[model samples]
Target: MVSAQPHRVGAELWGQLEPNAGLIILEGSSRKYPYIDAEALVWGGAGATQLGSSDNDATFEALVMTIKVRDPRGVSDTRLGRFMLSTGAVRAMHIDGGHLMLRARSKTHFEVFGGVPVDGNIEGRKYDWMVGGRVSQGLGNKGMIGASYYNRFNAGQRSAAEAGGAAALRGASWVDPSAKISWELVNPGLAEVLGTISAQTASRVIRGELYVTKRSPTRMLQSTSLFTVLGDPGTLAAGGNLRWRAAPRLDLWVNGALQDAQDDFGWSGYLRGVLRLDDDGKGSILGELRRQQVATSSWTGLRLASVIPLYEDHDTTVGLMPEFEIIFPDHPEPNQGNVWPWGRLALRWQPTKSWAVAAAVEASANQIERYDVRALARVSYQGQWPKK
Candidate 1:
């Protein structure tokens, strides 16, 4: 790993011979305020290979690059490019092309982006492209209004399989076009509202959300969201949450979502409460209840977790966390419900400002049937190099 102010780069390489697994990764990023920022990454891996086989053993797991530039005034631009050789590339979406985005602003703002795939497969084709843009006008204290459109094209230009079969699978036009109108209503410290209505070649959707919060010795917050998708059967969803901290030591929260699709309706709810025993919150307990019903099946569960300080001194501290959970399923079979109990004991020793050691062990069991255990230990040291 290498790092500097506003810049960082890291890489990891690992291999195992017993089962024949190997991985290679390289990533780096840099940022310069009010000027430019850039990042690049390449990662690939392979598993279980024969020493002298003639098969293709190389895979181009993932490659990505991003760059952003901003002027001191009202202009900014960004570019993103990606290529994936295998679907196992983690933490990134598969993209075989590059996209460029530009924005200019004053009171009214305009944004545009376009991309063309350089490699990989899309919609049974070897190449594809997309273009999109948005325009927005500021409304002072009220908020802003914007409209955006995006279109994708050339989705079936090449095929690795039968030409006819590929064409048939990708449909007549591999292009998708979508447009949306969005509005924002801002009230600053009190509340805010946002809404958008969008239509695509396949479906139309409307979404709205509201948030209200108050910050004080006793904090409170509330949020709600609604979504409606106009597809073949259509679907509607609504959800909201409320959280309140009556004191520094106590808090309560609840959230639930309800969805209706055609003749089916489903909903889920979660409730949680927390209590702290110390001003620093080093000792705390939490309890949660969750319930969900989908189609014809439903389940409810309760969980309780706690953290207690076993020993604490000037430079060393030890803690323990005990957790328990039980679930009830809406089924007629016996032994369908289970209880899980788990606990973790941890120790931390920091004798100096530059060195520390920590260790933890966790164990759990299900309904007194079977048990599993895990242990972890780590030592860390930190130091500063001489300035150049």
Candidate 2:
């Protein structure tokens, strides 16, 4: 009891570097016995200076550190520090703020949060605070309806006042629909609506997913900058997908989407199939055919990928993965060829329970360059103190 179990701790690290520069990211968490946990994460790059010298300035930022607490009775909870909040139809927002949730006895819950935008490009600090709230009520059994509102200023100007509503059906065997609508209260008054319906057969051999989205792209930016003038009316898209289990080891899918925009009318789709080579499914291969067209540009592509298990045991495993893609562009770029192809082969080894290493090489031709190749190696570890 006095030894404290050797102060147990586990960590994982991974990054891609060399020939092609990349960043390293770290994430860790700590917890106590009662009901509190704290976590921090950081990721940044080592890059050349502004003047383009040989020396590299490395930067790793710890932008997130948060703690959460909840009442034992499950009636209320709160989160403090930096975290991401995504409510109702609102996309995820990364802010340094706190969130509170209260659930009443009548199957209704309310949530509220406020925070300042935590980003590098945010210019003004005085008018950067953001706030939003959501309220939801559960239906008799397997459904709920919710409404949310968000407001904030950016660059010392009134940027947005967004309101959204959503309704969904949960835990249903047949087709279920979830729909959301959001509107912006700014001058142009942008609005959006999206819906999804999914179904699966009782035998679970076939499935279907359908969705449609109509939204204004300009809503992504609420700044007072002149760039906002570049936004147009809106875009509408409708898509559906079907999944079929062709055999005990084979699955197939077909999906496509159509878009109608003022500048471009286009559609994109893919047909894919995967065959399991072994019982574990790790030794599997996938093939896909994809095609897309917009305005005056269009292309058809073929992709093939496979995973091969070389060695496997209780504590260690070795694997090989290879992928290739070829695209035939109707109209090629200025310098690149009409046919674009890229291929990669990788081998990975996990020597022990928590140690892993992988090496790969790839070659590709793109609009910027033709006939280029590169190689990379990476290692990662996940282990706990006292030998787990």
Candidate 3:
């Protein structure tokens, strides 16, 4: 396992049970404060068996858990867990309590999956299972083609608690389904192109999309997508990005996107440049300029940010980062004709191999109409044995 911090907890066990079979087990957990006032925990375990010559011909089971806790103003939490089991013949089963999924794959590149509702949500929303399948065919030196489909029914109930009265409760149901087809072509050093067409039904409404992407050896990428909703508006969008290595210590990137809809058309573009003063991004400076327009709102902005290491050791490091942004709105009347500005300062410290802490403060103003301030602090710890 690999980690950004020096401390972790992980274990593995392996043994041969027979001439043609073997068993393996693994467990690991890690905690980190990747951002101010936010603590995240990631842990998981897996077990597997080998029964044939090919490594793919094995049985395996795995489970993962993730939790995040944050307090920028008040405390908030998010948690999720997943469990899966699979056999050697490409058959698998997975459950997350709220839903269960089954999958099967064949050597001919055909795959299928089905979902079943195992439990309802806190608000009593019940899903009525889903079935999906995909088939792909390789075109040898050309590329590949694939098609997929999925269908499901969703149901929900309005509880008395939310409706403010026991007699006000109600239930609703909808049938939803989607289908897609895609093709790809690859030309080494020249370009790789992919195109897809998709359609979906939601709450009796239908929507369709056509998307395409192209990547070339010139450190550039481009994409375009067109979307339409039956009896509604349509949209066409395009985007492109370019990156330049420049030097070992400096890098530059530019990105732009344009969108056109029945009622509005707008474009957004940005350029960013970064200078690294250290090999590990411990000390770096970045500058960016962005321009955007959409409907009646538009803005041109510039941002600068930097990170500096205050102290460092084999197992610990202390750092600081400061950032600032300036904005000018094209519609001065809506923005009060005043340039908006925002700034943030952060401090982070890792005093031990298994512990880290961070704190940050932010201040912003909206054209003299309002001013806001916020602050946050977080701490995390991790430990491991039998270090590898």
Candidate 4:
């Protein structure tokens, strides 16, 4: 006979010592959905970074992938991995909780924009996924926050590794997207000392879903020397928007942001108006302009773009757009040197509502200078799901 105590927490079973009898099996919920999403882009053209030439065409290709799944309540949700680049290289994979989560940065391409302080991804491109809870009860809205990381398991190009060695990797280069990472910080000297804090506001009216957010990165450092002075980028933004239903599928929105300098005390203001031509669906003509005003420089340029919809009615879609990007980095100086002109054509496809694949081809030339073309493709994905 085996003896056991119902109050005890541990016990042996069968041939082993019998233990506690008070143990109870707990039932947990299961996930409701398993979702997979992917995005990819291939580009070919010319640029300063490709083919080792600054005056000729550069050709390149890229891709992106994002995957997500739902889990039960109380337990951690599955992670959503994202990779965005001119190539289909994995860059970031993160999970969401609330204020707590993990983010692992890849080593291939590093990007630094504002003066925001950041630590290098010590865990490299990969790390454990972590996230806090959602933001709903308080704001009457829904969103998630999480983190993730990834690591390199091997070194050769994906195709090359399949063929087995350095030579194969080299041979695959023509088709394989170049991999890289970017990290940078902006410091605006002298500008921070003389600037004033900004206060801006905006409103928009339309139909559909309206995602209005204040204080976004674009509203901050678009054209400032802040990356040169303050070390921390300045961006203050506020806006309200709505999607309307009418002819040309019109959408009216107004936005403004305060762009402060880095070191000295100076501030630039930005305001934008957007009009969507074919509001009945997803095609339209878009225009944008940013007013650049620093202590010594002040100028503005406008852009016109034609938007085409792809894969309508699906959680994923595609679009093709072409636009002109003109920047007068320095103002007043008689608009001197090159009145540079450039045009870009882009193809963007999304496999999931939260992910997109983008490819861009650009060509530029100063009437008298040599012309060049550049190409790049990227995969970008983002998602926010309410915990269940």
RMSD of each: 14.8, 4.3, 20.5, 21.1
Worst 10 residues of 3 by lDDT: 160-169
Model 2 stretches astray by more than 4 angstroms: 1-10, 18-34, 48-55, 120-127, 188-190, 352-355, 371-388
Model 2's TM-score against the true structure:
0.85
Stretches of candidate 4 exceeding 4 Å from the true structure:
1-70, 78-248, 262-279, 295-297, 308-320, 331-336, 346-361, 366-370, 375-388
- 77-162: candidate 1 lDDT, tens digit per residue: 44456532111101122454443334444556566555554432533444455444555555554345555444444444221110
lDDT of 4 by residue, 89-133 (tens): 122222221121122232112211111101112333122222112
Stretches of candidate 1 above 4 Å error? Answer: 1-34, 40-60, 63-65, 72-74, 83-105, 116-125, 139-142, 157-231, 280-283, 305-327, 332-388
Backbone clashes in candidate 2 total: 0
lDDT comparing candidate 4 with the true structure: 0.35
List per-prediction Cα lDDT, in the order shown: 0.48, 0.77, 0.48, 0.35
Give TM per candidate.
0.53, 0.85, 0.52, 0.38
The worst-scoring run of ten residues by lDDT in candidate 1 lies at: 159-168
Q: Of the candidates numbered 2 and 4, which has the greater TM-score value?
A: 2
Q: What is the Cα-based lDDT of residue 306 in candidate 1?
A: 86
Residues 258-312 of candidate 2 have per-residue lDDT tens digits of 9888758899899999999976697999999999986676999999999999999
Q: After superposition, how far is residue 36 of candidate 3 from its true place, in Å?
A: 29
